[model samples]
Target: MQEQANLNRRNFIRISALTGGGLVLGFNYFLTSCSTSQDGGQVIELNAFVKIDTKGRVTIMSPNPEVGQGVKTSLPMLVAEELDVDWKEIKIEQAGLDTVNYKRQVAGGSGSVRESWESFRKVGATARQMLISAAAAAWGVPAAECATENGHVVYKGKKKTYGELVEQAAKLPVPENVAVKPATAFRIIGQRTRNVDNHAIVTGQYKYGIDTKREGMLYATIIRPPAFGMTLESLDDAEAKRSPGVQQVLRFDNKIAVLGRSTWEVMQAAKKVKPQWKEDGTLESTADYTEKLHGILAKKPEDKPRRQDGNIGQAFAKAAKVIELAFDAPFLAHNTMEPMNFFAHVTADGAELYGPIQTPERARGRIAELLKLPEEKISVMMTRMGGGFGRRLMTDFVEEAAMVSRLAGNVPVNVIWSREDDMTGGFYRPMCSYRYKAALNGNNELVAWHHHSAGVSGGGASPDSFPAGAVPNFQVDAHTYKSPVTTAPWRGPTHNYIAFSEQSFLDEIARQAGKDPVALRLELLEQARANPVGKVNYEPDRFAAVIKKAAEIGGWGKSKGENIFQGFAAHFSFASYVAQVAEVEKQADGKLKLKKIYCVVDCGTVVNPSGAETQVEGSIIDGIGHAMYAELTLTNGRPDQSNFHNYRMIRMREAPAVEIHFIQSSVAPTGLGEPCLPPAGAALANAVFAASGVRLLDQPFIKSGLFA
Candidate 1:
């Protein structure tokens, strides 16, 4: 049957187009890590690498690790959507270790949708178009008259499944230009579909970053220096080796890595290997971090302006009223549900690795650089990520795993980073402070605005929509500090901090001008829409649309029940737009309780209502976690908060009921993963000011006792 299928594929037009493009796709299929099948029978590579047989069964090539974010299911949706296959008949596969065929397998920056959207469509459409051409040639009908549906071609009331035409299609020359379906006629692109891996997740059949099992695999734990930049002096490995189940103790650079039979055994044995180390005093305390940032900000402003508009000094002088507010937001951890972990096996010529990595390409380079091997020799497989939030984007954990495994002499090694290690070992959202000054004319309209932010510069941070100079008379600049702890892209990055400061200041300016906060912003947005001030970075129409949508959906001007106040904010990031209105009540004792949240978005086209909604809800939770109770502070040169017990995520009981609605548009989709974040912080701050007459200037709002 398999031989016949291969022969038929050779004759099919589908094969011609798929293979032609497959060649151009530069898919080096040889790199997929292969091992014996689960039943210990035949050799099989990771199923993520899918292949279609002559029978027209579609195969998927998934590369991104699936965390709860649904890449496992959603990434495949793109392929299936363009293939015109029956959703019920679709068979999904985890992509094998093939770097040539797949790039950007790592899923961070909410980039999976944005990056894969075009690639998957081309792959599917190429195959379908080829199949249609083959059927057209075989039936002696005009190719234009042949339409493909459910993996078949039909013309003049005659139909045949792709399987029947495969042999003939393979014989036809591959068409250079295959017609693609019109967006208006799409059957699956915008429809709601449940996650493909839902059952696996709910039933515990889903393999997470830490769930892989390998033959003769050993577990390893690293005893890192008590502080960053510290060097290992000596270690008594005999004691660790004496422990039952302990395998070997390897020392390298600045630490000792203990490998053992199981995770628990390695962990237990690592505790006994007390290696001495010399601290470089590179560990920074909160005071040091703050002082350094303050000093950086105090420097003479570099004339290299990030943003500028109308003469801000002149506008301030002409203004009737002016208000200034300084706000601060602290450092935060990504705190993804799954800590960093990776499995690796090293051979003399090559290495195979599996982990919950967000940047597989980046990981490949890092591994090759560290292991000193040809890049092609290392195979990095991305598994289902437990949760990235952005932490998995760093390949440090994967590097450690590969190194340990290589030293273990061919035995597969699983390197696990405990929550404590993860919290402290990884980079964090940079700490920041913002200073803003806004002026208003006699008519109570915003006139001039200047915002200056200081702290660790938001260099290479993901949600790069900040420095939101949407006003006619505005100026924005940021100052950064050099610190030992690394910082990766947090959910919204600079937007998270800027929105809180800018929006809160806007609220204050509105109060000083004796105008409603939402109305004040609407006026500014209207100005941005009509005679958009300066060459700002915002899409004025989309920006205005979100505000209008939120107002309509949220009953913006309506009063809340007694003692409740509503705050509103909108921001665009990840190439998409999001706006939110948060309703809050300030308790007598000063507790801020989020009652309800209304979110409006325009992500171009909605792929799945349920999926989009899920993303929105998750973003809200993520944002709320940062706003209410999440922080990673340092004390005495060490991370004061380590695990979930110290650095908290919002629990189910604390999550606000979120309502999400998207504007209708046929435009190409943008992004939904990170756009909703900035506004959550802004809206929450606005609510606090409105409800209690006391403005909560910073994040982890719970610490402010605003709700108390």
Candidate 2:
């Protein structure tokens, strides 16, 4: 199936002739062949991304959804760079969901730039070479002598704008293998490029999923089960249907929805509807879950060993000192600024969905399955998301919208989840617990390391996490506890919690050994570099480089006046290494203040320096906010926190100054979206320890009562 899809994507490129003698290049991933004229003559296959018009304007299609990660601008920058066009001459348009052509249009995992770096550059280079070939033929000069610069091809002293040569270029066959410019030749990839949609976003002209509209679209709000593991037994929607502007009230297997002309009307009507849910009484509260976790740990469930080395029993038996600790992290809500919402128009013939989805292909597939329709009949369009952070990866909301539209007499429907609905909705980061034990010899040399983690089946630390291969005797065991609360991947997934637990515990070991935390980590990295045991997933040199660079940038070990202290941490995730040093101070009111953060990353080959830095800063702030305040507790199987008022985020006043540095390397770039986040929580926790002398064994430090 995939091979067929690939072939279809390559067989054709849709090219539309502009009214003013220009070309518009569009791609349909499902097209099996090129469309020909009625005369049965071969049509020109303009299978390239670059488009040129009579006015010399260049338009590039950004193939991925932009969730404020700057992908819309950065991806187009790749094409503009290889096309050798001036930045001012380019315009960007968001491409619709095209799995076959785009080949992974999803925006999660921070893999956008990593996956597109070479492919997008080739797109531009192919077009540039074709245009150069056309210009050289017209000038009667060798193609090798013709060079492209600033949207024009130059041969000796004669030059022609790409617009003047595009018609001829469209007729020329695309090169099978085009040579893209080297990193040194990059003029836009590593430069500071402004976001293409900044003006629209700032001026409120940009259309998000919630802003989507159609001629006769009705608004909908679903009334879901009040508690986890509950079923909708009955619902009374008579009041809802009687409300002003309420069009209809429909009931599904698990939800009752109110449809109305306006969002306000639907929301008001939904509030009047009451749903009775049936609970099994087996669902446990957060406190009960914590107790169960402890019980599971105490019973020492059969070891699902992920990694094992030398015998840990002997090492610990002979050790002079053994330190053990437990860490806990509660379930977390994504709380995307734009709540879950989607616009769908389902008809007897086909279905159309539009929203801020990170995985449009997955949504399309699920919707097709639900509707019992062919995949080709369903269209999923992506809108700029307010924020994703892994929440948009799920297609539940999209499917709900399609279902609502189908039940509303095939009329277009916009399903919008209120802030409260979004918070209470399932699909949270799984609550987890980690138990760690370390053994040290008389010389205080690290000897044995044992780690056991338990969480919702799919979420937890990777077996090959840092220090895994650095220790002489290392073993990792994992267990899972099933829960009714639905769980999915959070920003960094398991790394977010694991980093805090592992790094903070390493700091504890450093204290026990009377060694500086940074120096201790450096020592372990040096050991891994010298004689690594087992398979080391990260580059020891790259890991150590960021740590050293962050230390230097942060002025580590330097006095920062009274009551101010710094803490350091480093981790590897998503094929990138990041190290952070956080400076913290205690306020007069006893609250913690994060003054500054210094971060160094080595994700290899920076795509856009400005965008990369912005992502790192944003990740750090998100990490700090979640670490300090974000928590979703449960009571009677329902989420306790409803909105930002209780589930606090990092306010502007609480945001710290972040300084980021990227290592210069020629290797292929990796993901930056998630790597920086893992270490931020650990760095902040370590810094808080330095300032308050309090160890945080759990997340959302506000609950620790140390600040109070």
TM-score leader: 2
Q: Which stretches of candidate 1 lie over 4 Å from their true place?
A: 1-51, 96-99, 441-444, 456-469, 586-591
Clashing residue pair totals per candidate (backbone < 3 A): 25, 0
Model 1 lDDT tens row, 1-708: 011101122222222332221111111112221111222121134433334445665556566666566666677776666667787787665664555545556565666766666556655665566678877877888887888788778898989886666545445554443345678877888788888888887998988869888999888888786655567888888888999899899997576899888888888888888788777756677777667766655665675557777778898999888888877678888877787889998888888988788777888889888889898898877787777877777788888888888777877999987777777767888888667778777886777877666775353221124324445577776767666667877876566666666667777887888887767766776676677666655676787788888988888888777777888887777777788899887677766688889999998877777888898988887787678888777775577887777777788888888998899987767777778877887887787777777888766788876554
User: Candidate 1, after superposition: displacement of residue 690 in Å?
Assistant: 0.9
Per-model TM against the reference: 0.90, 0.94
Q: Candidate 2 overall Cα lDDT vs. reference?
A: 0.83
> What is the TM-score (0 to 1) of candidate 2?
0.94
lDDT of 1 at 371: 84
Per-model C-alpha RMSD: 5.7, 3.5
User: Across residues 1-708, which tens digit of lDDT does each residue of candidate 2 receive?
Assistant: 231222223554534333224443333323222221111122233332455665567877787878888989888888789889999778777777766656668888878887777667766776688789989899888999889899999988899998787666666655555688988898887888778888888998988999988999999998888788788888888888889999999998589889989989999988899888898557678998888777777776486688888888899999999999899999999999999999999999899999999999999999999999999899878899998888999989998899999988999999999999999984799888889999999999899999988785355857899898899899888877887788889998889889999999999999999999999999999989998989899999999999999999999999988878898999999899999999988777877778899999999998888888989999999998899889888988888988888888878888889999998999888999889998898998899899888988998987777552
Deviation (Å) of 550 in candidate 2: 0.6
